[model samples]
Target: MAVRILHTADWHIGQTINGWDRTFEHAFFFKELKEIVVREAVDAVLISGDVFDNQNPSAEGMRMLFHALADLRRARPHLTTVMTAGNHDPAGRLEAPGILLEEIGVSAVGMILQKDGGLDLSRHLVPLKNAEGVIEAYCLALPFPRASDLPTLTGESAKEAGSPIVRAVADLYQRAVSGAREQIGDAPLVAMGHLHVSGGDESEASERRILIGGEHAVPATVFDESLAYVALGHLHKPQRVGRDTVRYSGSPFPLSVSELNYKHGVDIIELDGDSYSYERHALTRPVPFYRLKGKDGLLVAEVEGALEALELDADLPVEQQPFVHVDLRRQTSALGLRAEVDQILSRYPVRDTGVSIVSAKEEGQAAPSEIVSLKKLEEIKPLDLFYTAFEKEHGEGPEARHLELFHSVLAEID
Candidate 1:
């Protein structure tokens, strides 16, 4: 029988959009996900990482995750789930209940442990079984590696391979795969990770840039060829990198407007023997996103008129109402933008994401404008602000080494 595994990532269970709670959306996703597990008869579920939006997720977020995991296991008694920690997760917190969670058929790996002064290969290795209860595959349940978690490398040898970080990642995977093979003895191997692989599309507004081991992102080849399928997280858009077998299932819903068109979904990989294939299943968006503008661009003077002229579903409950974004021509007083948009939006039940103004002088050039709610500008990350300031002062962004130093110092502070 072909062993079927449903792969997904970037849950961000406690995530919020424009300061709005996504608990309802997450609940909707989980209900459907449980239904999928039951309907498809999946043998296993692989959650790559980013289980929670922030390291300190609210208690409600934890409860939601626990309930969802319990429900999934009950939906398919034989279904095995492998979940790992991502950059945003508190590794220890996610791992604290590991032993307890195993009772419900979940294998959560938050951090790579140590044993006798070497990496703990056994902790990262997990076995997957078919409906017949026969073990058919092995998984390297590796979590996101912090800088300290990476293996040390030095000298010309590390340099010859590539950046030390890239070489270290490749080395870690090689070692893990070797150890897994030593024990599993060639049952097809699969793996999971949470990192920015080169070529994967990113939604910069929501995702964080986690620089580790002196590199901002690593290449897809960091995975060993022996891994039949690699489930990845980090970037919000679902995509394949370097090879089709390595893929990201993307987030289940839009986390930011930059991801407005992203196909939020799950990927099912069916593996039998040495051959495998995958298919994507799109999830219905619980809340719709609307960008209000004319073919040219909505004029600021017509903003109220347009708001009055639009039609929206009246049956949608206030919480499930569509998210609205308004666009206007530049030169609209930034000072009055929020008041004007708020006054107009107050008439409708929709949630306003923000207002953006296009530069009229550069009509043909399409550039994404900063949201008019000073909140967008207020949300500028330290790194981004530093990058802009450095470029303005030095005619260029900071060099990689400079960035690496900054990342290291910041990590220490955190």
Candidate 2:
């Protein structure tokens, strides 16, 4: 019998974009995921990690997570789900309702614990069984292990020159793999990890760095050849580690502008007998993310043209409007740039679309002037300070109109 599984990770629920809530996007993603699960007739679901954006997620975020899971279970009563906690999640919080969740065939492993002062190997290991109650695969459900998760080591192993965190993580995986092999003997082993793997490409803009105890990544070779597949998380780009068998499913949505260009999706794996095959399933986003830049022209005019060129369906929902980042060339002053951009955008029907302005000037350019002496806070007037800063940046003090505006503001304060 073939065992089909949907592989996904880094849900990062409660995540926001530019201070705007993204709850609608997450809801749409879950709706699509449910459709995929039903269409594929998947027997199991493997969610790698980063289930929440932070350790303390909001109530709405928690509600969405539970509702999504409940909907999935209702759609497929025979489905089995295995989820592990990522660095962003509070392990204890995620695993608090473990006993209750298990009643619905869902298993969550937050952190590996010591039983009787010894590492409990069984906690990280789970057997994936079919509806007929037959064990088809053995899964090493390893969560993001902190310094306290691993067992204490002595002798030369503890005194290794490299990072102690790396050594401890490797040791934990080694023990888990050994225990799983001993229990199942080789029934297409699968391992789930929420750590950064060496050689895996990362979406730096979106993924949070998972450095702990001075250790950032683990070598891909640590997975071993015995495992049929190594499902990984932490990175926000779907990619292979050292080999195709070991892969990251990435985040379901474009979490940042860096991830906007690539196709976002999940992996569908079919494990039959001793062989396993997988395919990527692309997801359709409710709103497209775009980075817009002006060509060689006046900043205001360039912004106006770019916004005008975009063909958006105003009839669509607000969440369906495109989110854009506008880049403009250097100007004499950026005083009214945001207002100008907003004014141009308002002409279009995409009022709900978010727009951010960025200066195209190269960073780290030398200032036009240098300060000769530092003045004490009480010694310098507010207007004097503003003029000095403006001269240092623009090679000149405030213009007559700017000085007039400043004087009027002072008059109002008086």
Candidate 3:
């Protein structure tokens, strides 16, 4: 039996803390998802992890996701939706009221699997039989690995071996996959997990700090032959791990400008019997926001040229204007920068971007003396300046002393 599925992950709902509005992007993401399901005639949809930005999403965000899921269920009654919880989710929120998800025809594998010690692996072995009685495939839902859950790795002093965290995580994943295999029977299993795995090409979104010998990531080799394909999460860039069998289906929206160049989309996997092949579906973003670094005159002209030229591409819409990241390198005061950007923002009517003033000093200029003046203050980093000003405004006790030390260290010409 052929198993046609939509592979997607990292919805990251309620992720509006950054400069961009995630709500808008996610709204479009689901719309595109809906279109994909209808166009592809999908059998099931697999969301690897990070469904919600945080456990407690805003009421509006919840409503938006709920409505989208509801629409999917209504459109495709036979389509099974499989999802798992990522590190961002609160375990309790996904675990409670599990029955409600069944009614909606969305099989969420998050907190459900982790409840009552571990997953009832047997339940997943049963192949998903369609309306035509054709057995599609088996889905093994594993929640985000936690050190406390793996009984085999029990030891308070495990860290003495050096890189204890990496060993412990590997052990947990091995055990989990082993248990999943027993229940897998003869069905082609697709394991949906929410931990960082090795072998993918790292882009801007892939810029994250993984601890040394810690739970930074797991290798795709862990999945091995047991899983025909491993749908992964945590990293926001779509990439292949190991033998292309394991893949991280990156976030739908450009969360940061770092991800501006990444092709955000879903995977359309076509399964023939036990073997499968897949292709990427490119998503359409509203605007192409970019960071242009140059002098003042050059920066303004480039933005203007881009704005005027963008309209020629019929696929690109006016509202989808490129958000400008103005990095002007010139000798300008903070007040002057504020005024310049403000003028541009008003004239261009660009509501979705920002600017940064990076002053460029000529080489071999004499460095300033110890007594820091208001004019020299502009040379210091914005973060340093803010903290120093904060200390000056509010009498320094503990935090002020720390800020002063930071300011002094930063001011030194290294």
Clashes of each: 0, 0, 0
Q: Order the candidate numbers by lDDT, best to worst.
A: 1, 2, 3
Q: Please estimate how well model 2 matches the true structure, expressed as its whole-model Cα lDDT.
A: 0.76
Could you give me the TM-score of model 3 versus the true structure?
A: 0.74
Query: Which runs in model 3 stand beyond 4 Å of their true positions?
Result: 17-20, 112-118, 122-127, 152-162, 201-214, 294-322, 330-339, 356-414
| lDDT over C-alpha atoms for residue 44 of model 2 | 84
lDDT of 3 by residue, 57-117 (tens): 6678778867888788788777777767776665555655457877876766654344356
Model 1 residue 219 lDDT score: 87
For residues 37-138, write the lDDT of model 2, one tens digit per residue: 898888888999999976667788988988888889888888889999987776777899888888777888888776664456577677777767677876
lDDT of 3 at 112: 34
Best prediction by TM-score: 1
Top lDDT hit: 1
Runs in model 1 deviating more than 4 A are 158-161, 305-310, 360-414
In model 1, residue pairs whose N, Cα or C atoms come closer than 3 Å (at least 3 residues apart or on different chains), thus clashing, are none
- Ten contiguous residues minimizing lDDT sum, candidate 3: 368-377
Better of 2 and 3 by lDDT: 2
TM-score per model over all chains: 0.87, 0.81, 0.74
Better model by lDDT: candidate 1 vs candidate 3: 1
